[model samples]
Target: MHLYERLPIFVFEIEACENLTYITMAIRFNLDRTGRHLSLKDWQALPYAAREALAGYIPGDDDFPARLDQLVSDHLGRSPDTAGDAPDMAWEDTHALPPGLLAQCALADLAPPSVADWAGLTPFRRYVLTKLSRRTDKQNHCFVPAMLEFRLAQATL
Candidate 1:
């Protein structure tokens, strides 16, 4: 049997980052809203307490963008950019890779995962793959590594 067969279905390791910017990004994605822009510099400049609060805050309703703006204004001296509509994607589709992400995997020479394989992943992992494969990301150094880490793709020596 292959070594991967002996491993758990998910073995995620938390990667350390210098700022809370990605948390904000994940929040925006989860909320399906946008335009409360916080620059990376601004994100890094916030006090740890503020950052923690923002990261931990989950909106119980659809008013999250406004709430996020309030948080940003509390930390910074001014309101952030106004909230706007974000594109809705197939967040619930687990049977196949999204077209963009599949294309990315093909470009990387990774095998197209089976439907069962796709459904095996948690939503957060799926979101990570989707976010990394987005066209505007510019840097995708993490894509293949993330795929390998998730055991959805093989590593070529």
Candidate 2:
């Protein structure tokens, strides 16, 4: 009936006293509905990239999520920065805002619009750019792309 619900309720075979990795349980569609396989044909049908990504998973690795995020980015030629809220970034050696962001915006003659766009961003969005800019080792290759991405997004608005 579904694709995942059939992952074989191995828990039922294990004694209640045994330790298992149950975090939460939810009902989902399962193809077998009685066994624990992804329907081999279904697995084979997945794109090669997707299969490779799945093959790379290492159970119990703390950085698995980050690795997967990077893989997805690499596959799509996406910005290296994770596309969400950036942690707090306070610049001690540089100007308040990242210079590369400004320079790129100026080069495009979109400074005014970019500034307006940056100013109008929700605090979280602004934080993403600031965090990217603040990474000392990556400033040369990062942030500008992110800024341009935002600039393009703003253009459409």
Candidate 3:
């Protein structure tokens, strides 16, 4: 059985005033390795409609990795084009941390001093590292070094 097969397909409710729309979406696959449940904001980053459609269609017997690859490809293919926008997608300091346990990774000592030293990374980068650091196994040692490297690279500029 694949990861998604074991995971649950949830109904994501987007409310507009008095109306409530439930979109069937598989927001996560592995429960233990992938960590806690994802929120609406995280799902928003993905191709929402595609996920919703696939959630109902994918067979339980299908190959796990292949299905995941297809899901990712379909999701990426449906992404909105933002060619004219700025090419860089690094994190900025302003991007707010995701709720719950992930927030704890953002505190000093957990993150590297270099990451803290960076002057003006885009919110996306901050979000990436923040999220990655929290989700990754080496919550302390790894993130600190990665942050230091990021900071060092930034300092050369």
Q: Given candidate 1, what's the lDDT at residue 120?
A: 86
Against the true structure, what is every candidate's RMSD?
Answer: 7.4, 18.0, 14.9
Tell me model 2's lDDT, rounded to 2 decimals: 0.37
Residue-pair clashes, model 2: 4
In candidate 3 the C-alpha lDDT for residue 9 amounts to: 30
Per-candidate local distance difference test = 0.59, 0.37, 0.36
TM-score of each: 0.64, 0.27, 0.26
Candidate achieving the largest TM-score: 1
Leading candidate by lDDT: 1
The residue ranges of model 3 lying beyond 4 angstroms of the native Cα positions read 1-119, 135-141, 152-157
Score candidate 1 by lDDT. Answer: 0.59
Clashing pairs in 3: 90-125, 91-121, 91-122, 91-123, 91-124, 91-125, 91-126, 92-121, 92-122, 92-123
* 1-157 per-residue lDDT for model 1 (tens digits): 5222331222232233323434443454534445455656776777766665555544233555666667677777787764364443543488667876876777777786787887788766676677667763343777787788888888776
